[model samples]
Target: MSPAFRWFHQDVSSRYTGLLCLFAGLLLPFAFAPVGIGLLAVPLLAWLFFAWSDASPRQAFRYGFLFGLGQFTAGVYWIYHSLYEFGHIPTPVSMLLVVVLAAGLALYPAAAGYLANRISLSAPSMRLLAIYPASWLLMEWLRGFVLTGFPWLNLGASQTDTLLAGWMPVVGEYGVTLLLGVSAGALVSLFRFRSGYRWPVAVTLLSALWISGWVLQQQNWTETSASLSVSLVQGNTPQELKWDPDARTKILNSYLILSEEVWKRDLVIWPETAIPAFAQDIEKFTQGLSGLTKLTGSDLITGIPMVEKGRYYNAIITLGSESGRYYKRHLVPFGEYIPLGSAFGSLLDLLHVPMSDFSTGRLDQPPLKVAGQLAGLSICYEIAFSSVIRAQLPQAGFLVNLSNNAWFGDSIAPHQILQLSRVRAMETGRAVLSSTNDGITAVVDHRGQIQAQAPQFIGTVLNAEVLVQTGATPFVRWGEWPVIIFAILLLVAGFVRSCYQENQPEEKTRG
Candidate 1:
């Protein structure tokens, strides 16, 4: 065979391997729904082994990037639905846009792999196992924070149903990612190459850590407060109809009918913007609902549009209470408010979205008091951000997310958004109640498992007794500080070590 042909074949094989790893990572999360805990770790371990074998830093990065592309492509394929259905883009253009976004996201993982390779070059022994995992998590953290942050598929989310989920409340998802990556890397190192028993040592340590997680899972970390019987109303309204003047009554009636059936419950919740009108305009309607809440003695939290001082907000209003107003702080760019309006104002006209100039609320707004408990309210897109939720944790006993997923239609967007909410619930050790206009409305426990859920595109109400954890979890108290500090320290140490090694002089023997 020609040398050039051999090279091409080898490159294709490497890229294919990377793609497989990416697919495996994406599939790993679904496995938790049915597969045993023992089997769930196999794919991750395999990916780590692949990384270990790719001694070339460039090859390792390529593999990691391809893997990330596949994972995100599958996980966020629903993004195209929004572009096509609402953005009024051509189907092909919409698909291409989604692919480009996925590719940009994939870069973070590729960068992480490159950094891990650099660290491994310095310490190729079992020590690389620890450094690689820490560095990879640091990259994930950077990805979450840098440029408005899109932290969709952190590795720890895959273990939401496993005993390892117990670690979530203590360390948060980023920490869990660190632990999982380290364990996977150590396991790969232990068995893949003959390394003078160091591999065995690493594997034993990881096994012990896994056992520790099992023990922790059995412990009740927080005292549960009085369970609140809550009803989540999913209206299943289409995005096009949600804002239509003629369909306003239809949207309102849909939620009212579903909510009336469960008004006897302690609380009734509706997804974000379930009422597509401004608070001031809907005074009479809100008053009627308030009267119902008063009569039934049940608190109601529903999303609505609000306008104050010529500024619009995507907000949550609590009926039956004097303090019935909370505005969304973290507004979605383009969707809610356009950035750099001076330059992009014309783009809005092309996009053709109404109410694209929403304002942000204060960062330190108090949690909504509902059904005798303080519930943190994150409107739609805000739940994707950990810092926003972390800020609300101090005053909140549980979490409530109001989202209108109608824009994304019958797409995976709702599922992907729900997954992020589950991670937030696990991180804060708070029961999360997510109500959506088009569905995936569900209650996720502190351990990140879906306790109960309303299926997609279904006009239904889910009634359940959700437990609230009174005290704060470790994640809530410290937030992501520990992980951030650890990552910074690792990067600094790695850089210093690299410098020292590079500066070291080569000693000459007697020639």
Candidate 2:
């Protein structure tokens, strides 16, 4: 190698390479949806290949940790905005806390990278491709399940605008992530090969995958149902003013007026915590809305706090004769309910996020029935979780997400979150109606297309005829259990291969 080439290689070999790759991954999403230019994955796979080529498990773990630190530090920087803006934490404390939390969140990805490196030691070449992708998937699943589950920044989410998005309705986000990882590994393998012949073969396969995805995108898997006209009401209430004693009546009146305008629609929706008061406390208002619903022969679903037995719940109530309740199942950690109460209870009290001590509702609560159809209800933070939404799919014809995005201000966080809601809609083949406080409230079709949307910070009502799906996608029917099984099979296969290699030491020389 030339002197400059050798120097460049050494730089890439340093710990900074992983960090650089992660930063690239973080920033790439802002530039392009799906961020699939493969810049992030390329360096990431290169680091894994080099680590596996030479390094102990402990060393690999350290390298992976550094990579994760960079990834999360950049990706979740917006988290600190909430702490500083709403939690009343000092700027320095909020920054430090966000860094610590990001570091902790990085552990899952670090562990996945460490495992991939270890597995690659015994099974080099294309075998690592399978093991690495599978390992990443398993780690992501764990990240989503363990703790309160922060599945933000999943690789598949980056593919939202790409042709790969066609795979969403089938295998869902994680499956698309697995495919992305596998593609990355294949690309790395191609780069490692000096022979010109290998490049063409790899390129051909990648092209074929892209072509297939495009074909899938052109295919219409489900027909839209013309049975429902929905209006999503964006109250556009400011976060600071939302819970003010003096502003409560004004906030309530704003929603009431908007709801009145949209009452003629088959169904009307409001953002999460739009009422900013307990169901019992707002009985008079609820009754008035119920009466209005009956008078119009339409149903209204609104987000409100439900107090029961001294515990508060972030809940959605259907106001009409067929009224029912759906409490938010997946609460935001720290934002909604603080985890490890003994350790952080005091800190949580210091943070002034209203309604942070919410009680989780029963997992098996029935779907919200509105206008003769069952609507799957997912509150603000709840839509990020697939399993939570999956449980309600069997009975739900459409999905309704009520959110207060004013907490996120004008940041891309709301837009990104809304994208996840779109993915969920595709996964279940159900039209998603999202009503947000401070805009981006949209009516997304089953295919994940936004049919109508209100601009940010605008108090507006969006009217659209939403489609209801009768049939379920494979993902809706089986949920993450199928993905879990696939991950388990991959792990088992990797273990079996490892044992076989131990018995036949000669196979090691083949690579």
Candidate 3:
């Protein structure tokens, strides 16, 4: 083995290896939003791969758990802001809640590590190269699906500004994540085989993965067509004051006055729940706005709750030339609605989140027509789901995301969510107009680049032009299947190879 490789494995068994793993995990979040040091993800993941490959299954689980604990604690610290600041939870309780959540998330990684080590591939190299990568991918998929799926701080999201981002449209977010695991595995293979000729081959494979990303960036998956001028309104309304009966009129007037300045624009968008009243109660107000938009030859989209058959839906409604409504499909747990409400009825009361009971929109809801084009709508957390956004493609030319991030205070949730929006744009090859209640409102181009962004905690308008995209990207068509399929194949191959090797040893002994 190379001297560096030998030294690294030696250090992995050192007394402070657990501490080192935790420190590495803590640094992983920096590779993502707000602080965006994109290149850090690979090396850190490689280090974790090394620790897992060298440890027993029990030790690997511990290492993975510690790494995940650090990752969630650092990356999702903003969750505390929502709980304590908006949910009205006490400081002590909020801190405890954050720790509990982080610990719960950590189990996913721990399970991945334990499963990978338990599989017992014939060779150490195969364990890292095939089994480990598949395990990680499966766990990531589980994290995004099981129990309503947190899906935050995904490794692929860290590559948003990197050359790898170009791969998004072709292979999707999970594909990039799988590739990162491959790169990390190849890197560890270099150390495992440094004394042999195979190490050079490992180095070559690692180089190709990154070099291919740079090459992919030059290709355009979707062509930009007509452009429409749009205005995104940031009301800067405090969460505490938004629903107050006395402040309702003032908040409504604030949006109207801000929007009037840009009334001539092709489209005007308001953040989620900007109306601060149910759609049934605000028909007259909506008609007035609709009339204004019609007079100006523009379309208006605003967020409000829609009441139907005693069920309430968190919806965004179109006014003027286009008339449509899109309710949020993937609702935020506790924040949007309580899960298993009958059994856990009082949990909502203790959490104190507002608008805590909203019915989910139908899965096949059509895209909204606006500004002379078809626009896919994702309210709040829905945009984070690639499948949800992909369903709109080949039909919707642009994407619109409306969010009320005031509940998160001035924490990093808005910036993190903005990063996710950019990745969605890259994945679908569509321009995204992300309108937020207080901050980080911006326009993201099909290339996943932020064109223009409004400052946080400001009452202002972000005026920009977004292009309409006509076709669908490969990711939009194939969805997450390709990546999931690839991972499954790797796991199958690894197990088959292990079985073959075991039989070979037995046959030689019998001969």
Candidate 4:
């Protein structure tokens, strides 16, 4: 072939590579909730690694960004329903914001690809097996907390239904993410090196990882303390009705009517903002509910907004024998409060979101003492951040996440939250009770199995008995630092090797 023809062919191949990267990202969400074919995860990520391998640093960055753009756009597109349908924003603007958010998130993966290529390792096998995967894990961890974080759709969450979830109790979600990336990297390595030792090593590593996960899964890290009967009430209140002042009475009645039968149970849960009014504004009404709880010998946990002095907080308050109040720690940026400063504060006004400017609860607050055990508390978006839930572990007997999914309308957002809660359960060795305002009101046992669930768009109650766990998983004891530090060390070691290569004398060449 002529030199010009070869150049044209290479350029065309690169363009096709870019398109394939975007296609991988678009289909990635099927590996997650609602659809939940986690078997697709390894193949999808394998394609991404393969695409990144042959690209220059700049081309790799673009490919990685497009991949992330596609993944995030599909994974969290339900935000459009909240923004346009509930926030009352114009359709075009709502979609534009979603696009812009996806674009911003894309930068994390772009940085991963750039760093991986810029610090490319000398050994082909090492680069394919370790360097690419470490870069991906580091970026994934960064995405969870920087600028108030949106850790939605984490790769490990997809593994909740897969055998790899057995690794969650040992390594936590991020560790599982690293393992998943490594699995993807192994695929790329297997194809790149077809001879001798490297192929055998790749096969051994893949088989060992999966076999260990299966083995680790049979070992129970936590033991049952007591079996407690719990009921989760699904009010199914429409987002419009919950926020409207005139409909507060109807919404309040719906919950009250639903709970009347379950008050005899040990603990009854109401979804986020189930009261739909400030606690101070309904002091007497709250006392009546408190009285009812005392009468039935039960503890009732309900989401309500509270005010103290001048600050507002989204809180879960318990009434009856073991009473306590736990406020939400992490709040969603636009949905809960405005970030940065006053310039963005007007979004609440334009969007007309009720009780949107909530002050964040102190991170030091202890788990709530309710029912017969200490219950770790998370409100809505808080469950998305594994670290937030991790902080309360070993001490709290179980977990409870109060959510109002009505704002998301008929979208995968509801199911995704449930997926995150399952990951949280396995990581902490505690059963997670997910109580939502609409659909997916269910119970996830400590092993991350769904015990039972109520269908969405219905006013009902789900009753199940769960064992309160008494011990912590390895993930809870050591946290995510081990995996993160491992990734950091890999990059640092690569940098040192590159420096050594640069400092070495070049061999003399004959003229």
- Candidate that beats the other on lDDT, 1 or 2, i.e. the better one: 1
Ranking by lDDT: 3, 4, 1, 2
Instruction: Return the top candidate by TM-score.
Output: 3
> Which segments of model 2 are wrong by more than 4 Å?
1-11, 14-16, 31-56, 120-123, 196-201, 503-511
Candidate 1 to truth, TM: 0.90
Pairwise lDDT winner, candidates 1 and 3: 3
Encode model 1's per-residue lDDT on 19-115: one tens digit a residue: 6667665665453322324346544644644454554678767766776677677767777877787889899998898889888887877777777
**For residues 207-272, could you state the per-residue lDDT of candidate 2 as single tens digits?**
776677678778666655557988888888888998888999999898887777677788888888
lDDT of 3 by residue, 78-113 (tens): 889988877788999999999899999999889889
Model 2 vs. true fold: TM: 0.91
Q: For residue 292, what is the lDDT in candidate 1?
A: 93
RMSD of 3: 1.4
Estimate every model's Cα lDDT from 0 to 1.
0.76, 0.75, 0.88, 0.87
Candidate 1, residue 164: the lDDT equals 67
Q: Would you estimate the TM-scores of all the predictions?
A: 0.90, 0.91, 0.97, 0.96
User: In candidate 2, residue 169 scores what lDDT?
Assistant: 72
C-alpha RMSD by candidate, in order: 4.1, 3.3, 1.4, 2.9
Ordering by TM-score? 3, 4, 2, 1
